[model samples]
Every structure is written in C-alpha cells, then in structure tokens.
Target: MNNNSTGGLPVAETCNERITSPTSNLGPQFTLVVLVLLAILMVLLALITVFGNGLVILAFLVNKNLRHRSNYFFLNLAISDFLVGAFCIPLYIPYILTGKWIFGRLLCKLWLVVDYLMCTASAFNIVLISYDRFVSVTKAVTYRIQQGITSNTIARMVSVWVFAFLLYAPAIIIWEHVAGCSIVPDGECYVEFYYTWYFLLCASVFEFFIPCISVAYFNMHIYWDIKKRKRNRLRSTVSISKRVSVPSKGNGQPSRVSFLLKKEIPSLDLETEDGLSTSSRTQTPPQVMDCSHLSTTSGNDRSAALKVKTRSKLHKDKQIAKSLAIIVSVFAICWAPYSLLMILRAACHGECVYEFLYEITFWLLWLNSSVNPFLYPLCHVRFRKAFMKILCPKRLAVLPPSSQSSLREPN
Candidate 1:
C-alpha cells in the first residue's frame, strides 16, 4: 500500500501494520482481476478528470458569453482539476499499482507539492465560487457594479493559488529536514509529519472544515435570499396588479383605466350656449386617435415588459445560485470523508481507521475531479448549451446567435 491511505502524499499516513495491499488475502486469480479492474478505473478517472475540466477551460476560452467575472473562478478550478488529471493522478497510478515509490525522493517531493497545491486550490476556488454567489444573491447591485472590474477577479484567482500553496507547501518541503529525520520509508513517499496531530488538525481545519463551513453558510444564505426575493416579487406583482385593476367608486372601471382616459382623452368639443360646438369637433386632429390608443396600451405594455424582465432576472440568479450550491455540495461530499478520516487517523496515530477505508475515501476525492465536468451541465443549461455548441456545432447550427447571447448568465 502507499504511504498515505488518503491517496495523495498530502493525505493521512498508513501505519506499518496495514501497509499490505487490500487484495493480499484473495486468491491469485481474484487479486489479478481486482488489480486489472482498479487499474482501468483509475485510468478512466484520470481521463475524465482531464477531458472534463479541459472542456470547461476550452469552452471558456472560445465562448465570449462565458467570459463573465464569476466564471473566472470556475476557470481557475478547471485549471486545478485539469492539472490533477494531467499530473497527480497519472504519477500516482504507477506508485499505487506497484506498491512502491520508485519515482525517487525528489519526484516524490515534487508530486507531494503539486498534488497538495492543486487539491487545496480546488477547495479555495470552491469557496470563492460560493462567496461570489452569495454576494450576487444578497448584494446583487454591488456585485453587478463591480462585474466590469477585471483586476479584482484576477486578484482573487491568484490569491487562491497563492494561499493554497502557502497552506501546505512549506510544511511539506521542510518538515523532514526540520525534524532531523524522515518518517517516510525508503520505498515509499508521504509527508514526514503524518504523525503530528497538531499539524494535521490545523491543515484539515484550513483545508476542508473552513472551506466547507464557508460554502455551507454562503449557500444557506443564498437559498434564503432567493426564497425571500421570490416571495417579495410575487407579493409586489400581485399588489401592483390589484392596484391597477381595482374598480373606482365613481366609474366602476379600473382606476388605472379611468386615470388613463382622463389624462389622454382630447377635449375635441366645447360646450356652447345651445349645445356642443360642431366646429371645434371638426378641428380635432387625426393624431388624437393615435395618442389615445398609445396612452392606454403603453401602460399595460410597460407593466408586462417590466414584469417579464424582473422574472427573467430572478430566474437567472436562482439558476446560478443553484449551480454553485451543487458544486459546493459535491466538493464537500468528495473531500469531507477523507478529511475526517485523515484527522481521525492523525489523532489516533493511525490505529482507529481501517486502511481500506482510507484508500476508498482517497479515491473519492479524485472522483470529484472526474464528476465535476458532468455536474455543470446537469445543473446549468447555459453550460450545457455551450458544451453542446462546442461538441456538436453542426447540430446546433439551427440555433440563432441571439439565442446564444440570450442564454448568457448575468455578470
């Protein structure tokens, strides 16, 4: 088994007693089958992780509609996941199957650094996405106003990578030398401080616990904000319609209809001593008909247009919030088990948790990378259409350019 049960060199340590492969007890035939299956599964995960996130990056690059400020965070996430598939997963496959770190100490250190950096950056990007959605939901005006500013988005993206690197890179690099000895065996590679419960606690808190908490809090508020907005919008729309349609005491017609008529109707005829003034009626211009028609219809038209606009805007915001919530949820699910197990193992000095469980949960983290590509399309129609357009341009040729632009998410 690898040094870390959590899969990556960043994960929890597997003690000496449980270093044997899980398939050791099985018959040779069964073990071979299991190994073959595991190899294929891991390879597929690497491919999926690569292509899925790669597609996102590609789509973002080619599609101007997806160039919104908020999407830059997603782009950063895809870049991290892509690196995972491209570098981390591929490197780990050889060590995992062979049960030895033949890749050398230098490569192991590099792998540990790259793996932890990408994984931590992925978590940070998720936090940023959640925070962005929360702000867009609760403080939409401010978020929209700042949408045009590219520097802020760029800074946030850079900070995610920087903070992620700072979180674990220094410790991973200097822990062995600082401690005056390496905990890792000659044939395996893992963090030297796996036995340090304090370090694991701190790292886990920053890595999984804090990110998960922030995302949950933000998404909860987002849900509440969306619900409140929907309720308020419905109430306002109903009240406005009621006010517009309510019968007037004097005319028995809607007050708005009476008001429009009073304001728009022309005084074509004047009262003369005997009766109506015929000459004044004759001088009434033809534009009177057009003006009267416009006054009455324009009010209704404007009301309907405004209502549609408001509904569409709310729907778009809700979809975005929903998509972000799903992404955060997936991140939590993928990382939480491994993170908890890691902390538990660290606290117990690697005795309490089973090796197999750690291995299982470790793969679950990588599963997040593979699964993320599909989740966006499942939750977001815009991403789905954009992906479809990229994948099957001929099929979507019938769709007008206006339709594509209309589907663009609001910044």
Candidate 2:
C-alpha cells in the first residue's frame, strides 16, 4: 500500500491497490480500533449534519421574520447539506471499511451519481449565497430588494440546481450513457469511471476553483463597502459633535447661529422681551431654548429617523455579509485539499488514489456541510433564538436574561 495523509488521516488501500485493503504492518487489534473510531466519527458527522440542517430548515419554516429574500438562499443551502449528510457520507463508511464497493453495480453507479449531484449542488448553493450577500451589501441603498426578490429568488434557486446538475452530467454520461465504456467489473462498486481526467478537471474547475474565486471577489467587495459605510458614519458623528460643541464668542453657551443653521431656528429664537436678535441674547441660558419643540420639527425628526434607520440597516447587512464570508471561507478551506487530491488522482491516473486520504478529504468536505447550522448561532442572535425555540423551548423559557446576550451578532 502507498502512503498519503489528508487532514492527519492515513489512507491505505488493500489487495491489488485498485480498491482499499488492510495493511499487513498494522496488527488486527490496531486496525479494528481504527475502524471503530472512523465508524464512530462518520456516524457522528452524519447525525450532526442531518440534525443541524434540519434545525435550519425548521427555523425558516416557523420564523416568519427569517423568511426574507436573502434567507431563501440559506434554505436552499440547508437542503443541499441535508442531502450530503443523509445520502453521501453514510454510503462512504462501508466502502472505506471493507475496501470494496460491495453494494452491487447498479447501486454503486446510482450512489456515484447521487454523490456527485449532491456535492455539486452544495457547491453551487454556496456560490449563490455569496452572490446574494454581495448584491445585498452593494445595492441596499439603491434597491428595494424585498420588492423584487421573489423573481430573483426563484431564478437563483433554479439556476443553482440546474447548473449543478450540468456540472456533474459528464460523469453520468460517461459511466452510464456511453454504451461500450459504461461497464463495471462484477462485484465492484467504486467511481473508477473511464473519463477520470475530464471528470476531475471539470469537478475541480467548476466546483472548486471557479467558486473559490467568485466567493473571494464578492466578499472582498462586500467587506470594502462595509468599511466605507462605517467611515462615513464616523465622519457624520464627528461633524455633528463638532457643530454641537461650538461656543459663541467667550460665552460658555453653544452658538445660536450653529443651532439655527442646523435646526432652522427654533420658535424660541423669536425676539425676546428685550427685542435683541436671538444670537445677541448671550445672558439667556441655552437651557431656556425649547429644544424639544425643535427636535419635533417634521423635517428634523425625519432626518434623524432616516439616519437611525439607515445605520441600523447597514449594521445588520454588514453583520450578515460577514457571516456569509465566514461560511465561504470555511467552504474553501474544507474543499481545497479535496480538490487538490482530485487533481492529483487524475494526474496519477488511479495509481495513487489512497483510500484513507480520499476519505479524510471527503469528510473535510462534509464538515462544511455540517458547520452551517453552528455558524448561525455564532454570527446571528435571531438565528440562535430561533434554534433554541426549536431545539429546547422549555429550556429557553427559563433561560437567563444574561444568556440572551449570546444572541448578539458577532463583531
């Protein structure tokens, strides 16, 4: 057996090196222990992925507030992850342990197609997620995304699934549709199709490389926009404070001229009993001015309300953008090594496809699928609250007020 490690896991294949076989070097006890550990890990991963993505979907179904235009992408992603957890990861365990595809020819081909389909769909969904966040962050000030999101949402979801299917179509075409080359040996159930090079190239390029570049580009733009918005807000606050702090000529009172310029002169600016201009009434205490009435001015109130609303919206959008950026980053990290290995395997032409390394990389990809649910709690208070409401309503009922603080959006 050859040696290759992915994510610190040793991958060894057995027998003729075509499929996995046990090592002669490691004793049976050690191998059994390893197998048991791998089984436990795989089962645990699959369970968490199913349960977590289920919660994400449940949150969407129940929480009307979360059923927004942007969140539709999340729903799509959850579905794809659920498929990965339920369909892809579990089938892998037996193959790895037994070193053969004992599941028969038809089922093996079916498994290969489903595995490729779900994994491709998951990748495409992430691309959609990045695109959605980028649009939200870039166009929030200009567009009522909510008004037009239905059409956009439908189009995106359809496109993601369709394109994902197309990306993996070559595999199905070569292994099943092509008449002469589609045959698998008797009792074998692996993905050792005829077009390994083309399959690996297409899979790596479309699923990994292109998506990685798109995610990085979109997130960079979103990040830059957030910084620009924060800078503008800081400048506005500083300008307001400076304007408010200006004192008239040697008196400790703030300038009436500045306040008048800002608020269009309150009713108190009218001629006093002494008939002096409002600015000349230095002896009058600034507190005497009816700032409350000025604050209530329709134009001023609207302006302040607009500023507050805009600030809050920007804050929320930025938080969401950051959360999605983390998700994208996690996806890249999890999938990169797998993509690399795919390229290597293609280059080696099946000579170096280590069972253990492939499994390690495969699990890493699933890790991304499983992590989405946990990320919601880490980045968004609303999702955390929604999750708790679904998972443990009784526990949340007696939840400490301080614990609610955990729901705050991360910095």
TM-score of each predicted structure versus truth? 0.79, 0.74
For model 1, what is the error of residue 260's alpha carbon versus the real structure, in angstroms, after optimal superposition? 14
What's the TM for model 1? 0.79
Instruction: Put down candidate 2 lDDT per residue, 1-411, tens digits, no spaces.
Output: 232321111123222233222221222334777889878988999999999998888898998767766678778888888988888888867766665566777676677777777788888888887787686567642334253558868888888888888777555646433433333335555554422565577668989999989988888888887787667656654454544444344444435645653443222122222223233332345667443332224434433543565466566766767777786678888999888876776566446777457657877988988987677443566777888888889998897888866664422
TM-score of 2: 0.74
Quantify all predictions' global Cα lDDT against the true fold.
0.72, 0.65
Across residues 1-411, which tens digit of lDDT does each residue of candidate 1 receive?
Answer: 444433223332333224533323323333777888878998999998999999999888888878888778878989998999999999988677776677899999999999999989988988897798788767665676788899999999999999999999999898766555555766677776665677788898999999999988887787887787677657755644544453455544445554543333233122222222323333446555332233335445544654565566667667767777787778888998999887787666566888678878988988887786677543556677778888999878877888766655434
Judge candidate 1 at residue 346 and give its lDDT.
Answer: 68
- Whole-structure CA lDDT of model 2: 0.65
| Each candidate structure's count of clashing pairs | 0, 5
Candidate number with greatest lDDT: 1
